[model samples]
Target: MADPTRAARPPGPARSALHRLRGVARRATDHPRVAALTCRLAPRSVRTRTTLAACASVAVVLLVASAAVVLLVRANLERSAEADAREQAEVVARLATEGRLNALLPLDHGTDFVQVVDAGGRVVAASQNLAGRPAPTRDGDSAHDLLRGGDHQSVTTITAATPTGPVTVHVGASMRTADAAEDVTTAALAVLGGVLVPTVGALTWRATGRALRPVEAIRAEVAAIGDRDLHRRVPDPRSDDEIARLAGTMNAMLARLEAAGTRQRRFIADASHELRSPLAVLRTQLEVALAHPDPRVRSDLVAGALEDTERLQALAADLLLLARLDSAGRTRPQEPVDLAELVRHTATARGVQPHPVTVHAPAAATVAGNPLWLGRLLTNLLDNAQRHARTAVTVRLDTEPASGAAVLEVTNDGVPIEPDDREKIFERFARLDDARSRDDGGAGLGLPIARDIATLHGGTLTVVDTPGATTFRLRLPATPTPPAGG
Candidate 1:
């Protein structure tokens, strides 16, 4: 006996077949030669793929429609044949019932044969085609039956009660004409399909190529562009479609790339110029000190060299910090820092200066950021203020009541900056003749670095117009303050 569990399980012949087909496909794909051949034959261009897809879809629709038309024609012909047979049979039965049946029954145009039989199933009258043959046996109880012999026939039978006894009539219609018509229709459709499918494919291929012409042009143009030619843009087709949008986006990307490339080149040139100046100074001081014999002069020269070295170190640190900030994927540690406290501490850390620095904090202002970077930003602002201030520098921290943002302002009593120079001053290595001098500007990276740090913390740093003093304002998104005594 078979296992009960196995017998109880549902048959999965279809599922098994599907699994086998998948396995074969996987093996074929894994074979190196098969893979290479597939890749070689596959449509690589979008135009070619679109053409193939359109052709396949049209072909499938035509095939299904053709089949439906052929089937409908065949069915209608069969129905017509059956109706003719039934009518002929009814007429013959009426004649036999009236006892006026002739020795030979007349055949209609569509009817192939007509026969009349008595109650004992004896052929009483017949058409010329069946003069002596016995009546054919009924295949089924249906009024219409298909009889197979030298030719296929649709036969219909009817019985009538006569004066003598019950009489039966049989009539058959030949299917030869209907079958011939069906065959002709099939041939016609096959020929039409042969002509139409290729026409569709050709039209699709041509239309697809035309539609993708602009894309091909764009690709060629982009391919020919070199890194130095990032400013060059692909031609726009000017139509408001996906292809047009694609061209517009590509132009935008090119614009951004050109700007970035310009910035990179400027940064390199400026950094080289800045380093050359200090390096020349250091080399000259070292050389002079090595040549001099007086101890005091040598010591002073060494000290100047040391100062240059320290400046170089600071410049290197600033460059590295800028590099890190420029990286798009860099992550930094963040914690909540009180802006008010940071301002006071940074101001106090500056020690004594020619221009006294004072801090005012009315309330605690908290923000989330890297404390080290924030401190550097504050220090840079204070240094800039002290260098340009005539008498006093002021640092004030407050929170915007309407926007809930932490606002820090560093003000100096100095000559007001020109409106045109305010935005330009934040650029790397930029200096103003009135506001910045080689003797005190200190390389011009401080403000830029400070602005970058502010941006990194999701804030803005700008020079706001203050009546008699130059004010640099920093704004950062504020965090919620803690409860008083929690």
Candidate 2:
């Protein structure tokens, strides 16, 4: 049974109101503006980076705006005060001209007060709020004297004239008042900022994080998969963006991994199954040899069984060597070696058991190779030649400067091999369907192994048919000989 809380509640304004508020909150947190801001900020950019940027902008704006507001306020207030003083002086000028100076210089004028002085540096007439002292002036010069002296008073100054022997008037406005007003304005701004800055910053940070929640979720999900679950995928962000690109790349990598894993598993299974027969045969043959009684039969069986075992061993060795050569092909360098000397040594080694084989190689005939691998390559080729030929095999090495390469060829007579089968003959485990092939008792890995080694060394191994002869050619990069020991 459903829990009472889990049970569906009948629709009403109370529940509907809460649901609507939650939906609105979710929309606000994941707003498009927040998402756009998060996207404009790089993925590599962290929360600290965004916060620092916002704070820096706020600092610069506050500093610049506060400076401008202070400057403007100070200028306007000072101008207005100077204009009032100038008008008062003008009134004094009018009154003194008509002989009524006491009327404008009213003692009841509390703020816009005025003062008048004579050329003798004394305040002969003054208004309220400035009656006891003379008007302030530059040191060592009387304010009245300066007022009478100059028409234009500089830097926080104003002047006017009267009729009685040029009555000089000096005027001033309070700078302290201007500064105090500026301080008040800045303080108000700071107070407003104290509340608003944190609110905006917190809202921005939370909204940005909420909008990028999908990306965060994807990162956590991808991290969890590791190597064990390529099948698992990150939920695609519905928007077409960098996250989509990331998902695409991941999916492509997963496909490649899945294919490679499938191939690896199949390869292992095939290798195990293929190797079993030879291993079982060798084990059973040995066991039977140990169980035999008569000397003659035992000797013959042992020799035949030994040959099979050697063949099996040879096959395994060739398989491993071929695999190594194949793997090394991707990374090995093709350096030059003396092809003439290499082939001659290889043929001599193969001919040690007295098969009718002759080798001829010109002195400068060279090949690009690892000498060890080149030796093995020629050895495999000579082994094949020895197995197939009626009696005589002739090995030849020649260099062609025109082609910029050295060529080595092994020719065998008395076997009319078809041209079409040349390519097929190089494949692993491919054998001619004949008693001659059976006589050699090879697992058919030689020619393919030779081709692999040759290819690894930056050369080609191919058969060239000439009527009744089959010549296997190995063409390689020409070896340069430095002057004898120089």
Candidate 3:
């Protein structure tokens, strides 16, 4: 005996991806809660997926911050250099006025050098370290403009009457002060890049993850969820942001998926159970006939085998079609469909009485689709109506020519099904009778198959139930009629 519990249950789809950065190298300085959160989130999506988005956002901020630091340091250095240069120029001006510009010649300090020149654009004095005669100059006559800013390159000179006609006095300092200022700037930049980058980087990552802590908690809780606990949902922190909306949408989707999964699993189990009995009966009949020596018994057993084989075949086909329909979603196609004539022909072929089958179709209600799939879809609907229909099986195809969508509806009067069960009747192998009897012939895949075909044609197959009557409505988008000559 097959274990009843071994029957297959419809499994749920996989979860969304959200875990990449967390799985990377971690810090010991992290908080316990953050560690727990990381562990929860780490095993999810592959690394660097969400990391690039986060890194890109942080990179903009870090680049700006580091640039600001560099700018501030450089600005300070420029200000100090400007003040020093102004002070040095003032000292040299005072010496020239005192007539000591020629006396203080070739002066030098350990790392500093000075040069002074007369007013006549000639090197009057130079730093001791700056060897021999006048310091080299590309333009000796450009003294007027060069003196105002005390040029650092060649010896700086200004014209002044030095008791010996108009002469040029020049003075310069080796780039000690400017170099010191640059050294300070370089040191600051080094610290910012070396120290601040790592520190700020870690903090940025932690802060980002902290801001998204609720999501981490929700993910952990969601991952741990099983069928028994589907009703559990992540509560909304409700600051009205994308994160909150994500939590809300996830909760809603979970509810829908849970309900659908429960229904589907039950349906599959019921189908398996239903299939087992005929198989058992057929096997027993065959065994008994083979054991005995009666031609009649053998013939009867052979007939039983044939009938069971037919049922099995129908069962297998129904199961496969239902699986495809359920998995593909209701996003099928729309093509050339001639419902009025096709409806008449299918009814005639099925031998369903035309008197009961009312066709309210236009002369030609042509729509888009595979004709065979549509035929199968319609036949299933008609066949379904015939089973439980009492007085009539009314079929109608009402087309809205303007919008190019046609509505095909079949109404049946019979054992009044519950409002909810009317939709349930459309599920695979979903005959509600506990004691399997006359309803077993069709394999109960009609409504599901019809629904699939309707969906494939960009339509819906739904049940509108009233007392003693159930209507299966299939609304299919219409196909465009071919255009005439231009």
Which model scores highest in lDDT? 1
For each candidate, give its TM-score against the true structure: 0.84, 0.53, 0.59
C-alpha lDDT (0 to 100) for residue 433 of candidate 3: 75
Residue 288 lDDT, candidate 3, scale 0-100 = 88
* TM-score: model 2 vs. ground truth: 0.53
lDDT of 1 by residue, 95-177 (tens): 87778889888888799888787878688898988788676555654433323345777887788888889977878888898
Worst 10 residues of 1 by lDDT: 140-149
Candidate number of the best TM-score: 1
The per-model lDDT (C-alpha) reads: 0.86, 0.69, 0.67
**Count of clashing residue pairs in every prediction:** 0, 0, 24
lDDT of 3 by residue, 1-486 (tens): 866664453233311122223433244437687779878876453233344455566557766776776667656655554444445555555666676664444332321334555544366655455435453455664543343245343233444454555544344434454556557766766665666556655666676676578787778888988888887898676678888888889899889988888878887786887688778988988898889798998998889888887888877877777777677675555556678888888877877553367667678877788788788888888877777777788788887757868888888886766776767777666676731373334666777788777777778988876667878888887675568973
Q: In candidate 3, where is summed lDDT lowest over 10 consecutive residues?
A: 10-19
Q: List the residue pairs that clash in candidate 2.
A: none
| lDDT (Cα, 0-100) at 262 in candidate 3 | 86
Pairwise lDDT winner, candidates 2 and 3:
2
